[model samples]
Target chain A: MGAVLLATILAIFTTMILALWRAIAGPSVYDTIVGVNVFGTKTVLLIALITYFSGNDDLIDVALVYALINFLAVIAVLKLIRQRDLAAAPEGGDD
Target chain B: MTELILDVVSGLLLLGGAAFAVIGGIGVMRFPDIFTRLHAGGITDTLAPLLIVGGLVLQSGFTLLTFKLLLILLFLLFTTPAASHATARAALVAGLQPVTRDSTDQKETRSSNS
Candidate 1:
């Protein structure tokens, strides 16, 4: 059981790496946002798994709160990006 | 005996969920643009946690902890698509062009340009 749990955690870690790669190497801001969102998701899963691995269910609340915050963060970022685009729309006649 | 079976089943679910997350990450990396990438990132990443939490809930048996985990899944299911939609809309408004595959659309645009 421990080995199985460890393997799952390792897989999630690999996922975080891939998401981090995209967040750093992505061509556009939106791509980076997408990466960050994916990263948050994996983090939530990691926390959940860790709880089971350690036999502590208390952290489920933490996972739930993180999920809430993750959603807010994504919306906040989109709001900021939209504002920036609106601000620059006047100067950028074509695009 | 039943508890042991539950753990093994949950373990398998955990692995399956992790695989889904990795695939979503790869999709984010390999997809051509923001819109297409969202198609991968939004759905799978949100769904991954649900499966994982469901698995954990199974392993934990029926308890308040299970409800807590379910709440997390509910939160994710509610939010991820909203984020995806906003991100796609923001990108489009910010001047990112989407990749189109249909040749007729291409020819129409070409004719319009010429």
Candidate 2:
């Protein structure tokens, strides 16, 4: 069971590396944001798995906090993107 | 025997999820535009995490930790799509074009606008 769990962790880590590549080389800003979001989710999963393997259930709380923060960061970034769009719109009655 | 079966099943699910995530990353890397990349990212963001959390829950048994993991999964399912939608909308508003199989629509729009 430990071996299987370790293998799962390793697979997830590899996936994270691939996601990092996407984040670094994505074609647009939003794609990069997507990469970041995926990374955060994986991090939460990794934390939870580690906690389970280590027999320290208390770490689940940390995973929860991380998830909450990740969600907020994504929201904030989206809001910033929206603000930027509003600022960039043509001033003359183009809408 | 039950424990062994559970472990194997969980392992397979975890592996499958990880594979999907990697495929998503590849799609993001290779896709021509932001919208398709967002599609790939969205898949991995929601499905992959859920699978992994599910696997962890199976392994965690009936414990507080399992409950927390389930909560995390629930939260992710609730939030990731909203985030992806907002980001995609923002990108569209900011003028990022979706790559299409044919250029006729783009040309028509551009000529019509001009």
Q: Which regions of candidate 1 deviate over 4 angstroms? A: A84-95, B103-114
List model 1's recovered fraction of native interface contacts, to 2 decimals. 0.81
Assess candidate 1 and give its lDDT. Answer: 0.78
- What digit string (tens of lDDT, one per residue) describes model 1 on residues B37-110? 78878656666787678777887677898888888788888888788878887787777777777755643221
lDDT tens digits, residue span A1-95, model 1? 77877887888888788888988876788888988998898888788889888988788778888989988888777776777542343435542
Please, what is the whole-model Cα lDDT of each candidate in the order they appear?
0.78, 0.76
DockQ score of the complex predicted as candidate 1 = 0.51
Model 2 misplacement above 4 A: A84-95, B102-114
- Sorted into a CAPRI-style docking class, model 1 comes out as medium
